[model samples]
Target: MGKITISQKGSRTIYRVNRRIVCYRDGHKYCVGKPSSGSTNIEFDALSENIAHERCIEICERRIYADMKYQNPVAYNAHKVLNALA
Candidate 1:
């Protein structure tokens, strides 16, 4: 999995993969990389924030679900959720 970073410049936010330029804008969420020359930058601050936050929540949920699965394998099927979280 690639690491994600968020940066803010003036009113714009940039999302990068490793350190190479990806996308820039005035929001928290953006496409993971740079657009082709002459292309417009895409901003998804709300979606980005939602995805980031949802991943965090899914992490916690996975832990709990894992414990339950271990305690009673037949009663839980959290692998799907955990995979989605990842």
Candidate 2:
């Protein structure tokens, strides 16, 4: 994970993570980070930068977890079972 940053691209103010544009913030309307393949971009109104970043992180984590579960269900289940046992 990388730090979220605010940068200016022409007249647009966008958020980046490790040089990758993740979110676009224009006034009160905030666009969440890039979604996984086949998913549409998420947009919301009236959000602060911190709130947007938090949302972005949450989305990213969900995508990662979903991908992991799909790609390696055995490992994912094992991890979950271990966590439950712990």
Candidate 3:
């Protein structure tokens, strides 16, 4: 897999997976929350739903202005959670 880019869209941040965008709203939306200020990598594919939920919670708790550099942690974490659910 490749890296997913998280971008700001108004008050919420979006994750770019392949060509699809995932958010935290709606029933189908697996991951939701404000992304780290800079960038972060999440090991989504290897994470569990519980882990994903924890990661999302962590992201939600993060300061909006804090700088994040890796994307694997969030991406892979989400991927794992979503994959298990799917």
Which candidate comes out best when scored by TM-score? 2
Off by over 4 Å in 2: 1-13, 16-47, 81-86
Model 1, 49-70: lDDT tens digits are: 4454444445556677777888
Comparing candidate 1 with candidate 3, which one achieves the higher TM-score? 1
TM-score of 2: 0.43
lDDT of 3 by residue, 1-86 (tens): 85687765444445756533455422224453323323333534323323445554456545221322144567656655786999
- lDDT for 61 in candidate 2 is 62
What 10-residue stretch in candidate 1 is worst by lDDT?
26-35
Question: Where does candidate 1 stray beyond 4 Å?
Answer: 1-43, 77-86
Tens digits of lDDT, candidate 2, 1-86: 98777766543466656424545433323454343434433442223334555665566666667888999999989978997999
TM-scores vs. true structure, each candidate: 0.32, 0.43, 0.26
User: Quick one: how many clashes does candidate 1 have?
Assistant: 5
Which of candidates 1 and 2 reaches a greater lDDT? Answer: 2
Query: How many clashes show up in model 2?
Result: 0
- What is each predicted model's overall lDDT from 0 to 1? 0.51, 0.56, 0.47
